[model samples]
Target: METNEVFEKVKGLFVEDLGIDESKVTMDAKLEEDLEIDSLGIVEVVMAFEDEFDIEIDDEELADVSTVGQAVNLLHSKI
Candidate 1:
């Protein structure tokens, strides 16, 4: 999928699953700062991503992804 498609899919997932506000979910949004996603939430996000994209992301690589754009970029690179 394209980057915008990925962003929209993940954004919906975050809103439906995490109860994140739509206005707060932006491309530059920081997972911790904007979404208030804690450690467990991070894990859940990763899991949701894996399920959404049908790809696996190692735990080590999770730290490198801190923004919505980063997640889209990473997903783009992988899938």
Candidate 2:
């Protein structure tokens, strides 16, 4: 899928599923710091992404995915 498509999907997951504010789901927003998603929350997010894209995401692969852009890029690459 395209990067923008992945971004929109991720944003939807954050807003609809994760209960994050829509305005705070920007590309530069930090998933933990900016969005207030803790470790468990990150796990929830990873699971959500995996389910949405029908792909599995390794925890090791997500080591450096700190921001929304990084997550979207990772998912886009996977898709």
Tell me the tens digit of each residue's lDDT in model 1 across 1-79.
7889888998999899889998999999999988999888998999998998899999887778999999889988888
Candidate 2 stretches greater than 4 Å from native: none
Task: State the weakest 10-residue window (summed lDDT) of model 1.
Answer: 59-68
Model 1 stretches with alpha carbons more than 4 Å out = none
TM-score, per-candidate, Cα-based: 0.93, 0.97
On a 0 to 1 TM-score scale, where does candidate 2 land against the true structure? Answer: 0.97
Residue pairs in clash, model 1: none
Backbone clashes, candidate 2: 0
> Which candidate comes out best when scored by lDDT?
2
